[model samples]
Target: MSYVDGYVLPVPKSNIEKYREIATKAGKIWREHGALEYRECVADDVKSGEVTSFPQAVKLKDDETVIFSYIVFESRQHRDEVNAKVMSDPRLNDMMDPKSMPFDGKRMFWGGFSPIVEL
Candidate 1:
């Protein structure tokens, strides 16, 4: 089994390019640090639900779009190790500041998962 970290956030539509630039750099860093896979996806057809949905989950606005991202690791231990290195990496300094992020930090949500099935 593998461990995964997933995230959902709302980014300003105008900042999509900026967000992609940042994610690209981050994915490369994670891969270098041993992440099995790193993926970032933008919403193409997500819609608000009556009770809950990607848009509602991130309090998405008309000028914003949802970003769904994930990083996969060999295991929880590996994830922790990779994340520790990532956090300490000087290349991530600018990205460490919440105020300087491309999206609202308060609105983003993330969690670690234990895969229940692989095939």
Candidate 2:
């Protein structure tokens, strides 16, 4: 089964373009290092639900939107290997510093998940 890493974050609407640029660069680096798929999606029709919703999960406000993304790998071992290389690659290392990140790193949440089914 394929391994996956999912991410959710809050980004300022005013910085969507800049965020997209950064994501594009990072996505390219990940792809080059062996990620099978890298995708990013911004909130389009998201709205507040009576119970809970994506916006609520990230405490999104009027000026902010959510960025949902994921990276696909052949397997957990492959993901580990690729991430190690990606982390050490000079072209990507500089972006690891939260202070220099294009988006609010503190507002980002991510996790690795074991696929239960794929069909």
TM-score of every candidate: 0.97, 0.91
Worst 10 residues of 2 by lDDT: 93-102
Q: Write the per-residue lDDT of candidate 1 for residues 28-105, one digit (tens) a residue.
A: 999999999999999998989999999999989999999999999999999999999998889989977888898998
What would you estimate as the lDDT of candidate 1? Answer: 0.95
For 1-119, candidate 2 gives per-residue lDDT tens digits of 99999998888899899889888999999999999999999999988898988888888878999999999999999999999998888987676787777577777889999899999
Where does model 1 exceed 4 Å of error?
A: none
Q: What's the CA error at residue 99 for candidate 2, in Å?
A: 2.6
Candidate 2, superposed: residue stretches over 4 Å from native: none
Q: Please tell me which predicted candidate would have the highest lDDT against the true structure.
A: 1
